[model samples]
Every structure is written in structure tokens, then in C-alpha cells.
Target chain A: MKKALAMLLLVLVGTLLFMGIYAMEGFRPYGEVDLAQRVSQAYIDKDVTGENPEVVYGISKDLETGSANLVTSIIVNYRSFDTLGEVTVLFLSALGVSILFGSFKGRLRSRYQPNFILRTGSKVVFPLILIMGVYIFIHGHLSPGGGFPGGSMIASAILLMYLADEAFRIRIEGFKMTEGIAGSLYVLLGLVGLTLAGYFLSNFLNTGTVGALFSAGIIPVVYVLVGLKVGSELTGIITDFLKGEVE
Target chain B: MINPVLLIAIPLLLAFVSILYKGYRNNLLVFGALVNAGLVLTLGKGEYLIGGFKPPFGINLVLDDYAFLGLLVINGLFLLITLMSLDKIGENATVLLVALAGLNGLLLTGDLFNLFVFLEITAITAYILSASSRQYQHSFNYLVLGTLGSGLYLFGLILLYAVFGSLNMADLSLKMATADTSQLVIPSLLIFIGLGVEVKILPFNGWVRGVYGNSDSLVGPLFSAVYAGAMLLVFGRIFAQVIPLGAYLKTLLLLLGALTLIAGELAALSKTRIREILLYSSIGQSGLIVTLFLSGLVFPAVMQLFNNILSKAVLFTVAGQMADTTGTDDAEALQGAFARHKLAGVAFTIAGLSLIGMPLFYGFVSKINLLFGVFSLDNYWLPGVILLGTVIEGTYLIRLLVKLWMPGEEGLVSHESHATKAPLEIQRARVMGIVVLSAVLLVGGLMPGMIQNNLSESGRLLDETTPVYLFDLKGGQ
Candidate 1:
């Protein structure tokens, strides 16, 4: 009876809400007179020309931030404040998982260790994967991949080791310290931008010539910090998940 | 003229550093909080363009009058809670600091997406902090509900961005004026639901009880007083500035607020546990604040919010102590607790009187203001409902007081005999914290005029700080 009543009420409210929404202007069938398309039309034009008065000196994001990847430029330089918060959210999630699962204190291991081939393959492939992760973040401003994807890549490598070696134990404290330092530096760099220029997280350093590896002022630097911080935090989370029980 | 970003950046820096220096996490947090409080005090009002980017292109932070008042209340409550919970908080100190950073961002950020990001920061850390209790499931519930609400909020932002083509509040306000009103309906509802979740709007707030009931004594009040205050202020800003409200929207909010108040009061009356009663009362008070807010009475809404914060801080802290001493939160178990813990009883009585809106209490002034606001609208039904809720509120609180002092369980009723009936000792520090809060409540009530000028100024500032006015100011700078 209760379930039926709830369903009935839900349907009623949903219908009323939809009816109300239909009464508003500008909402039309998809692909018909797309009003939303015009909203970002100016931005798209700026993205193409690489010049918009919305930024400093009418310099394009490519010239100002020097990041080839528009998304990377957006995430790290133009709207870095949101990225700061996004990083904290990921860090907090890791912390919460660890708090609930406790630090892995050499607890119960896998029931069956991977065969010899799997173990040997993971060990040999680990450093190569780590280097790839580092490369991604280092080239975040000039390439497709950035901090979050790169960090997850490194964490995946660590997860491979956890699967291969049943007795391998990570020193949770060391990982924690790395995460903390990297997170702190991200903020410190933003503060540096604040003191050097008038704005917080402003590109205080020179926006080197476009397409250069060392370009984009603090964009690449912040991305690298985020990459390292996210990598270690994710590793900590995986280790906690694999560990059996919390004390 | 301190940079408002430092309000967020400094504590985050200290919190991160404290991880490497665990032994000093508590002291580091305390020091950082004091610095934050100092910065907020000296901070001048302005719009801070982040990354040297202009509005409509980059995120900005604002420190207008409403935000300044929010900062003071948030920082003041955080300092008190940190001092009171230093010994009991354990590893949660870092989490608390991070949550404070999130709250600061929530109050100051000027963009819609940035607001969403800060909302996640606050929710994630609060989930961890609230999960410290044995009821871990409650934290999981909080995570699910909070995430769902934020998801809806993000969807709304996407819709607004699609139609209006901007994420900055000022920019959006400029475009939204001519945008399709039909396209905005879904987004506005989504955002309202998202922000309302934090303020404990009814029907959508299933996780409230589990969170408030399970969090440690200090954290419960922190969530209620500081966290809720920030969220409420943000909600008010959105309605007053970002989205111009239609009559239909206002009426919808008013009805929801009335329902929430009645439901909360009835739930409080039904609950046997003392902490649960206080939790429901907290919800009811928030409901009252929301109702006044939706009525377009910004001043009285803020005043009521202040009263709720001060009184809840005292009530929740004392209830935590009482529960600790009695070993159970059942009202029957707390009979004669006044004899054993005189200080707690005194603090509870003062806070209770304030919550009941007795004359000479801040609650009384705020309540009268709210009534006037409602009466001016010629809305007899709302005033009638409010009076009914208040009557219901008075009956339960008075009943609790009787149970508290009327000795030996004579009028007290218990479903089961509590095992740990012996009164445990109370901590001097917690008692001291409650005494300080009580004094603030008394002083605020006795000298209401001291804040009248500032309150009216902030109330006027609330509407004047709209996006259009702010956008004009931005050009001069």
C-alpha cells in the first residue's frame, strides 16, 4: 500500500513539474531552433581565433596561457579556482575511504597470488607505466591527457602490482606525505600568483612562446602538482580497498 | 584590505602541511583558524578577479556586506567548535579545517560552477567528519543524497549555460533577463533542490537525523550552526540576486517552508531521545528562517538565522555533555541531571528560553520581526501557521524542561530503564564553551540595538549587491 501510494504521488508531482516546465518559453524540441547553441557561439569563435576581449589585453588563451589544449588551459589557468576545489574533493574522498577502511597494516592477503608470468610482467612494466604517467602530466598543456587522467594512469600501475604480488605492502604514511606536499604546493603556487600579480592564481610567470614544452606559465607546473597529488591519493585508496578490515 | 582568496588558501595550506606534521595538527588548525578569523575581520569589500581574468571569463570571489556577515559567523563558530573539540576530534581536525575552507569558498565564490565545486568540497569533508561515529551507514547515506543533489545542481548549471551562454552570476543575470523563461524552469528547480538539501529542506532531507544524531557533540552543532548558516546565505543570494523570483516560485517556497516547520515540530514532539528532539528543533528553526526568507523579508530572515545559530550552538553542545554524563540521550534517563550538572542545566535553560523566543532573548526579537514581515504581506494563513508551529514548539520544549528539573522521574516516562543512570562527570572546557555561547546569546538579546544599524545596512546591501550593480562596479575598478 505504501509503495503504491508513493508511486502515485511521485507520478503526480512529476507530471505537474513537467507541465510547468512546458509552459515556459524557449524550450523546444531537440534540434529545433537551438537557443543554447547561441549561448556558447561567441566562446567558440574566440576559441578558434584565439583572441577575445574577455581575457587580458585581448590575447588569445593560446597566447596568454600558452596551453595547446583548451581544456587544460581552462582547468588550470583561466578557472583554476574550480580546479583547486575539484582536487580537494578527490583528496577528501580518498581520506574518507582510508578513514573508513583504516591504513593497510600488512593485513590479510589475496587468497591466490598471480602466477609467475603475471608477477614478472607487472614488475617489468611498472616503471615504464610510471614514466608514461609522468610524461602525460608534464605535457598536459601541450597534449590530450592532463593531471587527472595521468594520475589515474599511475594509480592503475600500482593496482597492477597489488594484483600480482600478494604480499606487497605500501607504506601508507609515505604516500600520504606525498599527497599532502603536492596539494600544499598547488595552493602555494596559486598564492605566489596572487602576490606577484594582483589576482589569485594569475599567470605570474611569462607565458612562454606557444607550442613550447615549458610554456603556459604556471599551468604545466600546477598540472604536475595535481598529477602527483592525485596519483598518490588514488594509490592510497586502492591499497585501503584491498586491505581486509579496519581496526 | 586582505585578499578574500587567502581566506580559503591559508587554511588549505596549513591543513595540507599538518598532514606531514601530525603531532601539531590540532595546534596548527587552531593557529590557522585564528589567522583566518583575523583576515576576515580586516578584509575590505570588493570583487577579486582570480587568475587576472575578467568577469564572464574567469572565476571571481566577492566580499560584500552579506558575505562579510557570513564570514564572521562561520569563523566565530569554527573557532569555538575547534577549541571545544580539540581533545575529542582526534584525526578529524584536518577534515574540519578542510571543511572550513569549503564553507569560505561557498560564501565568497561568484560563479555558478565554482559554487558547485565548493559545494562538493564541503559535502565530501562533512561526510567524512560525520562518519566518525559507529553509524557509518548514515555517512554513506549522506554521500548518496548529497551527491544526488549536487548532480541535479550541475545539470541546472549546464542548462543555464546552454541558454544564457555564461557561468558567471553577473554575466548570467545580464543574459537571463532576455532568455527564455521556459528554459529556466528546470534549472531553477534543480539548483533550489541542490542548495536546499544542505539547509535541510523537508521531504528531500532523509539524511538529517542520521547525520546530526551520530556526529560527535561538537560536529553536530557545527553542521547546524555554521554549515547551515552558509548554505542559507547562499540560497538567499541566489534568490535575491542571481534569479529573480516570480510570485509562483515565492508561493511554492512559502508552502514548502510551512510544511517543513510543522513536520519538524511534530517530529521533535514525537522523539524520545533528547538529542533527537534538539535535532528536530534545529530543523524547525531552519524552516522558520526559510519561510521568512521566502516571504521577501531578508532582514528578519537573517536575524532569525542568527538567533538559530547562537542558540543551537549552546543547546547542542550542552545536549552532548548531558548525553555523555547520563550515558543515554533519553529524556527519562536525564531526570535529576540538573542536580548533578548544575552548569549544563543553567546553560540549557538559557538556550531553551532563547529558542522559545522569550522576551530579552535574541529569538524573541527575530520572531517578532518575522511576524511583522509576514503580517505586512497580509498573509494571515502564514502567520497563523507560524503561530501554530511556535505553539507546538513551546509545548515540547517546556515538556523537556519539566523532565529536566522535576526530579526523580515522577512525570518522566521511559519505555526502557537505562542501564548507565549514574551521572558521569562533565568537562570544564565544554562547560566553559557553553557558558561563553550563553553569554553571547544573552548579550545579543539584551543589546539588540547594537546590531540594528549593521543589520539594516546588510539587509539593504543584500539587494543592492545584485549582479547588475556589481557588474557596474567592476567597470569602475
Candidate 2:
């Protein structure tokens, strides 16, 4: 009865949200809204600080924000502090897992024995998976995939190994060190910006050209750090959970 | 020239580094806390932009009067709580460091989305802190509710962003002032429910009882003073200064606050357990402060917030100590727990008295100002509700204090012979910390002038300092 009532309430809420959103001028059926009238346009145009010409594919030089990916420009450049915070959220979650499961001695053994190909296949796949993860985070400024997804991909590789071979255990201490170093470097990079310039997390490097791999000066660097931190933290969480008492 | 971001950054840096040096994490936590508290003193009034971008475009940390004062009190209390309970911190030191960063971020951020990010960071750290008791059930409940609360807040914030196309607090306020505020009602209500969970409003605070009731001395004071104070200040910032509210929404929220206040006090009145009483009292105090904020009485609301948090810090510490020592916080079981520790006892008594708004204590100053603020707004009925809540609150607190201080049977005179045998062992550091907090209360009550000068002089925006700061920003004098 309670579940039914809650479900009904949810449906009512969904209906109201639809009505309310459509009623507002800003949310006027999404497609009818002018992109030029939006704040995101300024972000894409790279004109928050000073005026800029239209961004080009591989030609825009010394733009305010240098990321070709508009989302990356917003997440990494315009509002990097919030990204830092988002990373801390994941870090805290991983820390919570370790704290709760720190005392456990070893990994939980799988109930079924792994097949011959499965164990061998995971070992083969792990390196390839790690390279893919690196690629995703490295190209985060020019592509849709960023640190969060790339890091999750790395953790998924770890998870695969754990599933395939019951005795597979990576040293969590290494992951902890990686997470710590990566996180500190991210902040230190921001502080460097603060020291040289007057702002924090400032892109103090040369923006050669848009659509280039070397472009978006600090965005890629921060993304790489985030990828490392998130990867290690997620891996730590996975190891901690595997160490939990199996039912 | 010290950026306010360092207050947040230093702690986070320490927290990240602490993960590598597990043995020396406690030292890092202490160093970070001291640095943060020291840095807060140097912060003046201005907006510090991040990522080298301007406001409403990039994130900024606003060091307005509200944020500056909030940072001072929070970092001060956090430092004291951390130093006093170093033994209780154990493995939770790094978690505590991250929590400090999160709290500072919560107070300092001017971007709504950035605030949500800090909110999540703070809430997640709090979830870890809550799990320290090993009562996984309550912690789980808190996790679920807190996550849901933040989600609702994000939902509301997304709606606002959709309408305004901006996330900066000052920018949003300017836009909201000119917009049709009737469009704000649903999103406003959603935001309230999100904040209500953290603020311990009625029906939304089911997890407070178990978590707070089971808290140790370190977690107790930190949660009560530091976390509660930060959340209320942020609440005031968002609702009072930013979100332009219409008539119906204001009334609805104000009523919710009043109901929460009355209900919290009534429930607290019936509790026999010392920790439960203190926790419920905290809930009631939160409600009153929220009501003050909703009424647009910023000064009195801030006064009450600090007063409540400071008093609750002392009160919860003592109660938690009792529960920690004797394994039970039953007021009857732990009768005369303070008989051995006279200093802690006096501090607890003073904090309780102040909380109940007794004369010559800071709570009295806060309460009087609160009533005066309400009355000046031509709010007649609220005073009646507030006074009635105070009377009930006093009755329970005094009864608890009397039982803790003097423990004779009902038929006989209160005597030392009837003191609790439960071996209450409050450390020297803890005692000194509570004494210092309670002394501030006593001194604040006597000299409210110092606080007033800070407020009237430094708190207001666009004062002499802001013009200079803006001139510096625009690269001119």
C-alpha cells in the first residue's frame, strides 16, 4: 500500500514537472529556445573575460577557454572548482569504503571456479583496457568521455581481474598513493595558478590553437589528474568491497 | 592578498596528502585546521574568482560579511573540536580534514552548482563521520535521506538555472529581483526540502536521533557547532539573499519552520536520555533559526545560529562524554555525572542556561535580539510561539542540568552521596575546550558590542573596503 501511494505521488510529480517546465519561458519546449540568448553561448564563444571572435575548428588562437568540447570547457575551465569538488565526493566515498572495511584480511573467493579461457582472457584484456582508459581521459578536452568515465573503465578492468581469478589482489597501498599524489598535484596546479596570476585554477599556459591535442592548456592536465585520482579511488573501493565477508 | 580559496584548498591539500602518510595524518589534520583558522582571520570582504574567470561565468568565493563571520566561527569551532578530541579522531582524522575543506567550501562558494558540489562533499564526509558509531543502520538512513535531499535541491537548482541561465548568487539575485517571482514557488519549495534535511527540520530529520544520540565527543561537538552553523548560514544566504520568494511560498516555509520548532521542543521535553534531549533541542533550535531567516531578520538569525551551535557544542560534548564513559546516556542512569568534573559541569550548566536564554549568558542576548527582530517586523504571534518554546525548552534543560549537578532522591535534599558512580572521565583538553566556549558565551552576553561593531563596521557590502577591492579588481584606484 505504501509503495503504491509513493508510486502515485511520483507519477503526479512527473506530470507537474512536465507542465511546470513547459510553462516557463526558458524551458519553452527546448528546441524553440534561442541558443544565442543563453549564457552557455558565452562559454563556447570564450568571451567571459574579454570579447572574442567565433571559435574555429583548428584555427582559433589564444581563446579565453581553449577546449573544443563545449562541455569540457564549462566543466574544466569555467567551473573547475566544482569539478574538484565532484572528485572529492568520489574520493570521500572510496575513503568511506576503506574505513568501513579496513580490517578485513583478504578478498572474497568466488563461489564457482573460473574457466580456463576466462582467467587467461582477463589477464590479456587488462592492459588493453588500461590504455583505453588513458586515451579517454587524455582526449577529454576534445571528446565527450572524461575522467569519471575513463576512471570507471580502469576500475572495471580491476573488477574483471577479480572476477576471473579469485586470488587476484592488487596492492591497495599503491592505489592509495596514486590517489593521494594525483589529488595533491591537481590542487598544487591550481595553487600555481593562484601564485603566478591572481586567480585559482587559472589556465596559465599557451593556448596554441583550438582542436589540437596540446590545446586547452590546463583542462587536459586537470582531466588526467582527475582520471588518475578517480581510477585509484574507484579501484580502492572495489578492492575494499571484494574484501567484505561473502554471504 | 591572501585568497579565501586557500581556506578551502589548504585543508583539501592536506586531506589528499594524508592518504599517503597514514601514521602522520593526525598531525596533517591539526596543521590544516590551524592554517585554515588562521587564514580565515586574514580574509576581507570581496569576491575571489576561480579559473581566472568572472562571476556568473566561472566560480567565485564570496567573502561578504555573512561568509566571513560564518568562516571565523566554523573554523574556530572545528579547530577546537579537533584539538580537544584528538584521541577520539583515531582513523577519522583524514575524514575530518576533508570535512573541514567541505565546510569551508560550503560557506565560501557563490555559485549555486559549486555550492551543491560542496554540499555533496560535505554530506558524503558527514556520512563517513556518521558511520563512526558502527550503527550502520542509522548511517544508512542518513545516507539515503541526505542523498535524496541533495537531489531535490539539485532539481530545484536546475529549474532555476533553466530560467535564469546563470548560477552565480549575486547574478541570480539581481535577475530574480526583476523576474516574476511566482515562477519560483515550486523550485523554492524543492530547495527548502533539500536544505530541510540537513537543517533537521520536522519530518525530514528522522536520522538525527540515532546518529546524534550515538555520537562520541569529537563527532558530537563538530556536528552540532561546525556542520549545523555552516548549513544555517548557507540556508540564510540562499533563501534570504538570493532566492526571491513570493508571499505564499514564504508563508508556507515560515509555517514549516514554526511547526518544526514547536514539535522539536515538545519531543525534547519528553526525552529522558541526555543525548536524545540534546539532539532534539538541537532540532528545535534549528527550526527557530530557520524561521528567523525566513522572516528576513538576518542579524538576529545569525546571532541565534551562532548561539545555538556554540551552546549545543558544549552541551553535546558533555552528554556524549557521559554516553562514552558509562555506555548509557539515560539521564537517570548518568545522574550526577558532572559531580567529579566541576569545570566541565559548570561549563555544561552555563551552556544549558544560555541555550534556555537565561540572563547574563549569550543565549539571552541572542534570544532578546531574536524577539526584538520579530517584533520590529510587526510579528506578534511568533513571539508568543517562541516564548512558549523557550519555556518548554528551559524546563527540560534545567531539569537535566539539576539532575546532572545535584543527584539526591526526590524526598531528600540533593547531596554528593547520591552522585552517579558511572566513572565519568572527561579529559583535560576536552574540559578546557568546553570552558573556553562557555566563557565566550558569558563574555558575549556581557559585551555584545564587539560583535555589533564587527557587523555594523565590516559586515555590510559596498562599504569603503569593497570600493577599494573593486578598484583593485578593475585595475584602478
Candidate 3:
């Protein structure tokens, strides 16, 4: 029966691939597809809500979405609700980790004592990594990196601290507080848009020049909240994992 | 007018607040559920856009009658379940808050990929809720299947977006209406298999046995009723309304639903444990509803889904409570177990009888409409199989009800003294909640018009066939 099922699945897949490749007009070959015909063109040109056929970096003023990075403009500006949902997804995952390990005791202790160099190095490196993470999220609307990568980087820094110094315990309550406050402020910001403007997550701020540091309306602010929330959430998960369960 | 987006946002907001004020998480959960339930009632039928952008460009919440009906029932039940078992929500209040948001999003989102996002959020919370049993293996099993299911859903959705260059459901439907549906075979099938896992179609439901069987009272009703109902409603929304399918693929999926119905009933007939029987029954009902939707009987399909989830909520709660208290759910071990808890027994009996499609119950109304709808399709064989499945369903459910109500030696004189000594007690709050639900079933059963009116509301919005009342209706033709 299992063999027959496997055969059935194989036949099905093969048939689909053939049909998708040959008979499907909608499935045009990749490069032949016109980006101008896609909705993404509007995202790239920042012409979704209004006609800004051209979005020149550091030139266009008071355009629809001022995020210079097209991806950030789409993810954080055009469809910010989906991004909020994505943030909640990561938050829920980290929350799941904490709940499952809720019964655990203090941090997991290592057998081998780390050398002075490794411990000292993680401490010396931690501040720099933190700053880099902050920079990435702060410049998310202008550059490639955003909340998710930046937050994970911050968590990685905390992981380094754990590895190097066993007794170095960052208080988990502080991280939880950070996670909660960041997440709540994110939603509150969206609500503020809903109240002042007519839409949730509306770009209610003065969206200045595209490439400027303080532009992109609510995009940078959202990314900053997302970064803090993700950073604290991942840190909370790490803390829960490290804290061994007690009977 | 209430913005439908608030239904998805407030719970999320409260959930975020919950993590900060951990001490007040349960209070926040109740408040969120209350706020959601209250908000949904005031919401009118319209498309509410997010980010202040037009449809086909930005995300929107479609609060048509179908979505409104879903929001009404799902939010109502979420509120009840939270109130019913607030004590059981220890350490998981944040998860419930997020789940409420996710379930609302699943029902309301007009964008397909946005639906996938909600599906993931809801699925992850389900995994966390399942783990509340401390049966990590079962939760892990559920986690793997659910993740795979959502991934496939996303894959299918991405394909659709790539093909049409849009993610809006209405726009995609319009696009697919013009395009050759034959080309859509793979994406539609991929979507079917993806949603099939959560909808509990026969082959894709390996996690049901472990997850549902191990879940306690709080998690059981929420999963079986709220989550299951929302997913089935979404299935109807997508398959029956959105994605136009070719004749061949349509027939193929119809046959799959038929197969699931029969197989689910047969499997349920063989189960001795309470929750397992109900889980299989839930699958069977899902299949029956899926078949109805695919057959183009949207009204009956949604109504049948309503009946199934409503009854399953009561059934699973009692069954889960039994296992929680007695540490076992074996039917023989729980014989006459409901003797002491008469109110719970009555609720269980009403739910069971309704599930068996007994008259003057909501299930009977749905069953009649379903049979009428199927017969209207001139599909004789499926109705016969449905009848046979109903017989098997009735036999097992009645047998189980008898065992729970009357305990004695096999063919000898029955006595209350013969009841099992297993001490079990339903909480006052849970009993009240189930009583309220059962009363709704009874009321819905007696006044079929009340339910039909709501069905017609959506049918009119959908521009589909109007729901048929008891004997015949204006739209039966």
C-alpha cells in the first residue's frame, strides 16, 4: 500500500510539472515576465497610493512610501499588517519556547571552565555587536538589513555572552519587559494611525527625502519596535533554553 | 461601524500586553475575547482595507456575510470557551490571545498570502496548546504536520500570486475566471492537500488521533470547534467561491471527500476511546461538509459545518473532562460515568443526538438540507453512502451515549448502583457554557428558520443558492 501511494505521488508530481512547464500560459518563463505588469512595480516606484512614476533616492519629497529600500518599503509600508503578523509569528515561537521550559531552574551550567581570553573577548565584542544590530534596524528603511536580521544578531551577541561566561546571567524579566513593551508600542502605533488617519499602519509622519535617516514615515519606527521585540523575544527563548528544569 | 481589522488587532495588542503583565494574562485574555465578541456584533458587511490602500493593492478584511457569520460564531465560541475554562488557561493566556487574532484573520483576510500568515499563527498556537498536555510527543507530531501543511498552503498561494501577479482573493478569482482553469490544476490541488491536513480529510489527519486524544477539556473544545470551524469556513471560501476548478480536478476532489467521509465514519465506529471517536467523527463531518461545498451547495455546507463544530465542542469537552478526571477515556471504563453529572450528561446526550441528526436538533436541519442538496445534484450514490455513514454514526454514538447513561451487567437489570465508581465532576462554569451551547442547538433545531435566515444572508452575499428550509423554500429550485 505504501509503495502504491509513493507511486501515485510520483505520478502526480510528474504530471503537474509537465503541465506547469508546457501547458500553463500563466506560468511564463521567468525573465520573459514583465515586472511593469506586476504589482511589485508599484512598490518599487512607490506609486501604490499615488502616482510617483519615479522614486529618486534622496530626491523625491512627500511621496507615498519614503523607504529607499524597495523591499522595506513593501514589507514595512505597503503591507505592514502582514509584517506585524510575521513579528507575532516569531514572538509566538519564542513564547512557545518559554512556556514549554517554564518549569526549568536556573541557567544550564557547563562542565569546562572557559579561558580568560574567550570570556574577555565576548564581553569586548558584545557592545560592538549590539551597536551594529541597532544600526542595521535604524537604517532598515535606507538599507537592506531590517528588524529580523538585526534582532537575531543581537540575540547572537547574548548567546556569545552565555558561551563565554557561564555565570553571566542577564535578567530574563528585563528581556520579557522589553519584548512586551516593544510589541505593545508597535500595535499602539498602528492604532494611532487608525485613529488619526483612516487606516491602520498609515504613514502619518512627514516622509521626507527617500534616503534620509529620519524618512520613510512610520517605517523606521516600526522596524525599531520590531527589532527590539524580536531581540528581547529571542533573548527570552535563549534564557529559557539555558535554564535547566527543576523537578 | 466597527472596523473589522480591530477584531484581528485588539487580541494581538492584548497578547503583547499580556507578556508584560504576566500576572494579568488570564484577565487580559477574557477581556480580549469579550472585546472581540462585542466588536464582531457591531461590524457591518463590507471590505475593510488596511494601510488605507485600495483592494488588489493592499491587504483588506472581507466582512461579507460569510466572514461575518464566521466571526460571529467563532468569536462567540472563543468567548464562551475562555469563560468556560479560565482556570485551564494557566501560562497559556498569551497563546490564546494570539490564537483569537489568528483565527479572526483566517476568516476575514481577503488576501491569500495573508490567510497563510494567519494559518501559521493559529497552527503554532495549536501546537503550544497541545503541549499543555505535557504529552510532548503528540504535540511534536502535531507541530510537524501543521508546519508542513502551512508550508504547502504558502507554496500554492505563492504559485497563484506568481501566475496572476496579485494576491487579492477577488482579483485572483476574476483572473482565474478568464484563464484556463486546467492550468490551475496543480495550484488548486496543492492548496487542497495543504488545507486538507487542517480540515482533517482522511489521509492527511495522522495528528488528530494523538493531538485530540491527548488534549484536555480546555484545548479539546477550542481545537475541535473553534479552530476546526474556522478552517472549514476558509476551505469553503477558497474552494467553493474563490478558485475556479476544472471539471476533472473538481470531480477528483469530490471523490476524495466522499472517501474521507466513509473512511472517517468507519474509523470512528471502531474506536472505543471517547475523544478518539469524536475526533474521527469530526473528520467524517469535515469530509461531509467538504463534499457539500464542492458539490456547489454552499449554504448547506456552511450550515453543516456550523452544526458539526457546535456539537463537537460539547462532545469533546465532556470527553476531555472525563479523561482529565479519571485518567482514562475508555468507554467501558467510563460506563455510566455521567450519572453523577446529570447536567453534563444531558448536554452530552443533546450533543450526541444532534450529531446523529435526530429531529428537533440543529444537526437534523443541516442533515436534511445536506441530503436535499446532494439529491438535487442527482448524485444518488453519495447520498446512499452518507446514509450508511449516518447509520454507523448513529449506532456508535447511541451506543456510547447508552453506555455513559446506563451502566449495568450486559443483559441483566440495569441499576444506578452499577455506575462506575470513577469520580468525575464537571466545573460549574463549563457545565453552564455547554448548557448554553446545547440550548442554542435545541433552539436552532426547533426554529430552523432562525438558522436559515443567517444562511440566506451569506447566500445572498455569495450570490449562491439560497438555503432551503425544512420542507422546501423559494430558493430550492
TM-scores, chain A, per candidate: 0.80, 0.92, 0.91
lDDT per prediction?
0.79, 0.87, 0.87
lDDT of 2 at B142: 97
> Which candidate, 1 or 3, would have the higher TM-score against the true structure?
3
lDDT of 2 at A208: 66
Among these predictions, the greatest TM-score belongs to 2
Poorest lDDT segment (10 consecutive residues) of candidate 2 chain B: B468-477
Native A-B interface contacts kept, per candidate = 0.72, 0.83, 0.76
Candidate number 1, chain A TM-score: 0.80
**lDDT (tens digit, per residue) of candidate 1 on B1-477:** 689999899889888888889899888889988988888888877788898777677888877766777898889888887887677787777888898899999999889999999999998888888877767798889889999999988977876775565798877876777665556667888888887788888977889999887656777778878888888888876765677555677778778888999999999999878889988988888788778766667667777788888778877777776665556777876765666677777877778888888888777877787787778875879999889888988899988877776654444463224323556566887778878888777777898887776554443232354545331111110
What is candidate 2's local distance difference test score?
0.87
Model 3 off-target regions past 4 Å?
Answer: A1-23, A109-113, A245-247, B409-413, B454-477
Candidate 1 TM-score to native: 0.91
Candidate 1 chain B weakest lDDT stretch, 10 residues: B468-477
Question: Per-prediction TM-score, please?
Answer: 0.91, 0.96, 0.95
lDDT of 1 by residue, A1-247 (tens): 9999999998997897678656655545566655335534433333422454543422344456677676787889778999989998898888788777774555556668699999999999999999999999999988899899999999999999889887677887998999999999999998888888878888888876666787888989899999999999999889888877443
lDDT of 2 by residue, A67-103 (tens): 9988999898888898999998999999998899988
- Which candidate comes out best when scored by DockQ? 2
Candidate 2 — which pairs collide?
Answer: none
**lDDT of candidate 2 over B315-414, digit per residue (tens):** 9888888788888889887778777788999999999999998988998888888887787776667888888889999999998988887888755798
